[model samples]
Target: MMLPETLREIIIKSGFIKQEDFDGAVKSARELGKNLTDILIYRGLISEDVLGQLVAEYYKVPYISLSKKVITVDLLRLIPEEAATTFRILPFSKTEDTVSLAMENPLDLEAREFVKRKTGMKIDIYYVTAPDFTAALGQYKKNIQDAFTKIIEENVEKSIGKSGDAVTLGADIPVIKILDTILEYAVAERASDIHFEIMEDSYLIRFRIDGVLRDILSLPIAIHPAIVARIKILSLLKIDEHRIPQDGRFKFKIKENYIALRVSILPGFYGENIVLRILPESTRPLALEELGLIGHNLNFVKQNIRKPHGMILVTGPTGSGKTTTLYSILNILNTTEVKICTVEDPVEYGIKRVNQIQINPAAGLTFAAGLRSLLRHDPDIIMVGEIRDKETAEMAIHSSLTGHLVLSTLHTNDAASTIPRFLDMGAEGFLVASTINLVIAQRLVRKLCTSCIETYKPSEEQLSYLKNFLEDSELTHNFYRGKGCAECGNKGYKGRVGIYEVLEINESMRDLIIKRVSAEDIYKEAVAHGMIPLLRDGMDKALGGITTIEEVLRVVRE
Candidate 1:
């Protein structure tokens, strides 16, 4: 009898059973019976070995056993010295031990553990060879490389096609293949953004991957307009209408994954300055704790944001991840109980539980106008894409004071800089102080790939720079740097993490704002009140191997 026969008997007794249901029965039997194999065999359902194999498969792990009938010293020697060291296997016998070893696979940790514990001696394990190990390893490596290459090519085709912005060449190699090579290279390098600039004779393509600009391959200038047009088409913008700047957005679906893209086009000296915001499909909404905000700060933000009134502003420069942060917060607060509405220039990501509006300024549905109309619908939480003008800023402030929880973005260097930015927009200090609840200034830095990081003592000049900057503060003597590896696409870095500085306005800060304090002065006070500067936050993450020092310097300096 076999385990399958036992399974069949159980099924027949039950009339019929699904695999999952049968597994449940097996679990119950194991709990109630002694010597599970013997019980099955006595019941005329399974053989000992078959029962053993079933247990192995059920656990999805290799099985190893050492009965005095099946241990061998030659098998122990067959395992590589490195493998033995890793597994902590000790050599015990000069000749083969007559211990029977039963395992689904030789490398099973549980099997090894069982043998070592039962035998009270070290066991050597050997795997069956299939003619050529080196050749197999080589083939596996090549397959991985080829798979990566295919993924890259596929991504390029999807992005280009999504944009509808590349000239198709009906040649042997699709132009998309070249495009995929370039983008895969950029993404693999962990670039923050991709830039395409047109010159006289050539189209210059560069990737701001990892906060550093690297020149990618260039194309002939003749194809510049075609590429631009292709992008315009993909974005759903009118490709022929180039007289005025046009903006559009669309998503690219590749391998059942979707990426959000925002395209902006403006007339340039040589051609059009086109910027594409490539938002990967895998961006998950992180919780406040995950964002590295301290306990007090996290509590403050969550408490205030969860309230029914006031405005929360997330301020940062272009490409500083303001939108992502906003979206993440929105996701946190989104529920069926509240009415949330957003007016974006071009909505970046879709939220299931909120009403989202895309601004069509071309048709006179400006942010201010949209907000005014949105007020009629009675939203509990209002998201203004950006307070770009005095009108929109005034509207956002007024909305906050009118009992709506307003969220918006402002282009400023730091949290305190939001004050000066509002002032520059003709927003009175009193209005700003009254409406503002929280301001989060953030930047994105490229994290170092942990799989390929190297640590060293700081250079004298680097130490001097740090000393000069920190003055009396303590500094770590050693720092880590990224060394390019296959895992990180030879870029040494992987992805980006946020360096955030959150400013929660209390009565004191509001008073300072009402007094029209300078941004630098306000920043000073915020720092004194335990607001971590973006640079310091970046440095902390760098030390933790979350990002590289070079990336921190590049973004913080900017």
Candidate 2:
């Protein structure tokens, strides 16, 4: 049954916090006039969801889970948006004349009566926990999205009509103005990606913020070429090459902040679609502390980086912040005592005393070829950007075995999978096991905005997962959410943080690896030896409200 998971469940499952600790945190929150969520999250309590869950069970009302169900326009219009807003109830569906509304305070007869008076309809209410309700309600909210949406609308008005699928741009309109308007707006909103797409009707402009996209405005079909050309000129992509896909990179300075955009143009049915990845100036290498590597994961990497001759591999999918972690390691090991050389497709950042080379196979410098040339320089350490082929893989292993510490990244699900991947690339199993030191897998999740975070209990499904995972550990249950805020542009999330799991190749691991066992078997052996998985490390951060469980799942679930 899909019943509400309560505070009692949280208390029983956590097996950590007692009634006394709760009372103390509550008292402190009251004394300091601060959010109880803040106190629980920062204090390392399990989660803030327990109290609400307890109260929710105290009242015999069914719990409602938003984002699980669809909210259609017909249902939303049953009650005036104002009445629903006033009563903190979202009327999402109907059966006959009864309207289903989601609210946390189902016991409030006055609020129910108020909603009834305003709508004059039978009210069928389901309880929504605080954070869920706030988030659901935030969708209809207009504070932050409204302001930005207005800017997009104004831009549309300058060129296209309301339903102008067949609209044409005026010749008087400056082509560069449209390009600047979209990019500046995307940057101002802190979007990580911007998409220019061609639909059956018109051109669409969308931006990816906090890992989700929001469609902002449309442009006339006539202006598509000029817009594409403008971005091509900026990225140095071939403008006239409309029949093929092309990739390029350029840095744009907006309001004194340098923004690097990785531009890709692909041919589409309507026109050439362009996608720009916004790499802000902040991609510069961060210190180990800033990379969000905590606990044993941090210490393991620190210890292995000091080793003179071994390979430390960082694994994750594309855009998973793997480069940042590698750069962090490089920064620490960089000193006058040892020479460090890096061969990257595009040098991300420049550090002092580090020789960084851009891998340009088009100019006759592939990873294998450049690495071969780099080895001739007598470097104490080498950083190959990635090991994609057998040649590069063998070369990297050779570098590690031949008394040079090699650091590189691979496209793998986790550290455990990195072993099998290297073997599949034709490296001998013993050779893979002997020279490898540490394998770190990481992902980036959107950080909750402290300025407008909402607190609530987790659902039954969420509680079940936590119980299974935290069964053997100390658990506290206080969850947080980012309610729409003007400061965070209503996305609720403000920034991103890294979650990591580290695997150190010790005697036992090397033995198992030497046997050429399955990745799953090796993974089990590693875990049995107290290797922390990426999910667990991410959960640690989630417990502190540094991130959300939903966001963590988006990364590790893959």
Candidate 3:
């Protein structure tokens, strides 16, 4: 028997579907003039992704996931609409002689014959899940770009030279659906920020993934103001103001998954530049080990954070994942016995059983005021979102001095500058010395996607830089670079990990702090005390094949 027949027999015997179900499917197929596989699937007798997997394994063909894959109109045109509808197949990709089809039932022999005979080409089958197959089919039948592009073109007169059109056009394109597609696709692609910028000649849609911004699509400039208006309406920002920057937020859901996003709009030279930041909601924090803090750096954090009373500060520039590090440690430390309260400028994540408070400057709840109030709650540990000013810095340290473990973040370059920053904020040197326990400085670097990372020999200039950063005498370690692949959206990077420097305070460092030592001298002492710098961590990752040398230098060298 052929593999399809054998597979059908095996599936019938395997008990996912009964003999009666198969019989019903066959009877319905004869009466309804539909394929038996389509009948079974349409009657919800089997799962498409599962069936696709089985067929792929049996026939030794490739399986395709349409979730993150992009489909082009040109590819879809290869298969006629009638043939696709009848066979429940989608044209995924095409070559000169071989055409790849993502099918609801890859084992359908009759459908395969029709494709081969009709197109006069070799046929390749890929299994697609039921929902994905339906969505892909609908997508291929028409162009999605026309939906929004027409809306903008129609309302160009009202949209141009205005922040928002007084009259919103809800025709042809459902504003909600267009926005949903953008947000859903971004989440699926693992984008950190969704950027919409108005250029001189066009409207640009880009996604910032793995710390790099990538072009997604572009539209004519006439459509930008309307799109911006729709976003502002969704985010509840004042759409009429085109001159001033605005910050607003909204929650969006696709199916059962709901995500909270922060919206920031800045007035641009041509128009408005919008950024959407997805907040951590219903997502668990990564474990301490998963934060990429290795060796002594990891040990230093584990040791110092457990101290009953002192301050631990994580310092880095904006968007450096500082808040994420604090939340991860907070999750690890969360206990039924310990009471924890946080004062964040914008609370990003929620921990169960932890008392979290957000600082709203408009509500008389600044970071300092919030911390002062949080102390009265009698919590063992308190977290301040950021130490932006001297008052907040003084308060964070004083809270630590009163025998409370305080955790916070700051905007600084490295561990040595953490104290200098505090002192610059008008914090007393002795108070900073007594309360400070550990300072961690970090940067986020994109991790090379394992699916397509390629090994390469370093150049002479690359080797010279590595020798200065790394202590390796031979530099025999193999280096890897991302070659870009479909899985990673051709970006070569799939995710991000932190490169960190951990500075643990000792009695000698306390003296340096009290003496108001310069940042350079403080850094020398930290290096003497065996603190690993961010550059070293990046170099370690480089040698270990976790990232590339060029990527390491991208953030650290600068």
**Model 2: per-residue Cα lDDT over 1-558, one tens digit each:** 112346434554566666676667677676544455446544556543554444455576665676456576566656555566577678777778787888867877877887678667898877765545555654443333555566555654564432222212312245555666677778767688999998788888889886678887777775676677777777777666889999998888776678888888999988899899887875567888677887788888899999999999999989888888888888788888999998997776667898889988878899998899889999999999999999999999889889999999999998899999999999999999889999998888988876567667777777777676664343455677777564566777877889988999999999988988888988898889878989988887776667887888888887
Tens digit of per-residue lDDT, candidate 3, span 1-558: 123577787667767788887887676566533355544554567865566666566666777877656778777667765578788787778889998888867778999988888778898788775545655554542454454455444545443454324336322144445566778767766788999989888888898888888897776676666677778887888878889999888888755667899999999999899999987476789877777887899999999989999999999988888998999989888898899999987777768988899888987999999999999999999999998998898889889989999999998889998888899899889889888999999988898765455567788887887786667764765577777755566677778889999999999999999999998899999999999878888888876667777788888755
Using TM-score, rank the candidates from best to worst: 3, 2, 1
RMSD to the native, candidate 2?
Answer: 13.0
- The residue ranges of model 3 lying beyond 4 angstroms of the native Cα positions read 1-167, 170-172, 472-474
What ranges in model 1 sit over 4 Å off? 1-173, 176-198, 201-205, 219-246, 264-275, 292-296, 471-473
Error of 2 at 52 (Å): 24
Cα lDDT of all candidates, in order? Answer: 0.66, 0.76, 0.78
lDDT of 1 by residue, 1-558 (tens): 124564355434543334555554465345433233333432334433454444555545443322222224354444433344344332323344433333334556865875666555555553311111111222222333465566545544544333232334212143445444554544444455668788777788777765567775566665466567656656778766767887777666644556666777888778887766677767677776556554455766787798787889888788787887788789888988888999997777778878999898779999999999999998999999999999999999889889999999998888888888898899888989888888888888877664455566777788877775443444562366766654455677766678888888888899999999899989988888888788777776665546767778888888
Identify the runs in model 2 with alpha carbons over 4 angstroms from their true place: 1-173, 459-462, 472-476
